[model samples]
Target: MRREAMRHRLTEEFFARHSTVVAPDLIGKLLVVGECSGRITEVEAYSGADDAASHAYRGRSSRNDVMFGPAGHIYVYFTYGMHFCANVVTDTVGVANAVLLRAIEPIDGIEQMVNRRGRSDNLTNGPGKLCQALGLDRSDNGASLLSGEIGIYDDSWPDRSAGRAIVVSPRIGITRAVDFPWRWQLAAERNERNERRRPGGSRTP
Candidate 1:
């Protein structure tokens, strides 16, 4: 299959269309790094000021500065002084909205992800875990998912059809955004496939 070029990658409008729509659509998509790839599993939506669950609900700050920037940019932040979470900037340039990338099934660089996570199943199972597996840190905060080393690809995985994909309730983690039902969890097929491909198979959240 031909790889999608940078120009064909997702644009700002692509992200602003409606996070609930975009979240499930992102399932089964390929997040590529060099030869490695990961199938997106879980995602959550945070609207701008309208949604109290969103960080932009209050206003921009040193930590949420990226959400105010262009859409499709990575907005990664460290929380609890120990975990790192990641979000994809969305909405207009000034509108502070984002989609949190909650989990992924390692499709490539499993060994590297394992090393970074220090545990096989733990790798890429949560927001922070997936970021660490992908080598995402504060430096990549404003990085665009459209181009450069860390880019998204349309792998056109055969099983991504709507009927095959399963959508589940959001994971119970956040306190402030507890009531919102916008979070989405993708099925485990991708992770199972990855384990079959790599020995010493494992599972993740």
Candidate 2:
């Protein structure tokens, strides 16, 4: 299939739809950078106010305001005192919801992503790494993913039907509301590295 032609430039309504429906479905997808020709691999979803793990749990803020805007916009945030994390604003206007792009397998514009992230494989292996790999910062916050400079592509669909199931677990890197099972993961490639550091385990360096 012509990946680009089949691309569905999603809208806000797409985000507002049931997050559980969208979260795992986003696996095996592609996040493309129009200007830099970059592609990413991993993504995670956050439901609206009810989701204890969501930043929107407490309602909107100057930081999370973009998440309440029209869907298909970028919501970038600074964290860890050094890294910027990127998310796609989801749901209709006024509904604060988004999907955090946790990691990427790195497909194109690798050199640029490497330079921007200062590491090779690490460029898109974590939430912060994904932002760095895509050259995303606070400046990208609220940028439209359907137009302008950055966007998402639904070209690749992971093998959901394979015997392996999409891993649904708790959101990572949070201390409060740890009981909410709002996090989703795809362990198609179960390796020793991933096994050693299961979800809710010690922090990853």
Candidate 3:
């Protein structure tokens, strides 16, 4: 099948809603950072002020002020004192909600991503991993997704298997709010297909 060459960027209006509403919906979307692009495969939602796991739960600080900004902006931050993670701010200003990008299915600039991460099997299967692979860090914080170095695009291709592809689980790597099923990811079969579609696989270019 021939693929179409087009990118429909998601509008800010799409993100001016609850983080939970946007988290699972981001699956299958395309995330672009400079020359690299990938299909979003996993994400976690964090609602500020109430969600104990959220950074904004205790109110705004210099480090988390971006989370309370307008929607459709990147909110990059450092964690574990050594790793970086990226999130997409959601909801209207002052809401302080965001969607953490956990994993992505590399679709463009695969060689670059592999070089950055030194591995392909789990290049972007985790938040910190994906951030490193995409060269995102504190410098990318508060960047507008509508017209910035980091952006999410609509794949345009019809995904008839989306319902079967998505699965939910409690957010990982977090000790608080463990009961909320706020994490979403592509199913194992979908991940296998993604791997098979890579450069040296049967679906090679």
Structure candidate 2, residue pairs in collision: 12-71, 15-91, 16-91, 41-104
Tens digit of per-residue lDDT, candidate 1, span 53-99: 77778888887889888777888898878878888777677888778
lDDT (CA) per prediction: 0.71, 0.69, 0.86
Number of the top lDDT candidate: 3
lDDT of 3 by residue, 1-205 (tens): 4544667889999899999999988988999999898888889999997899999999999999999999999999998898999999999999999999988877778888899998876778788888888888898999999986678888766543356567788888889999999988877552275421334545333
Q: How much does candidate 3 score in TM-score?
A: 0.88
What lDDT score goes with residue 76 in model 2? Answer: 92
What TM-score fits each model?
0.81, 0.80, 0.88
Ranking by TM-score: 3, 1, 2
Those runs of model 3 whose alpha carbons end farther than 4 Å from true positions after fitting are 1-5, 158-163, 190-205
How much is 28 displaced in model 2, in angstroms?
1.3
Clash count (model 3, backbone only): 0
**Candidate with better lDDT, 1 vs 2:** 1
Q: In angstroms, what RMSD does candidate 3 have relative to the true structure?
A: 5.2
Question: Can you write out model 2's per-residue Cα lDDT over 72-104, one digit (the tens) per residue?
Answer: 788999987999988877777887778887865
Q: Candidate 2: deviation at residue 82, Å?
A: 1.2
lDDT of 2: 0.69
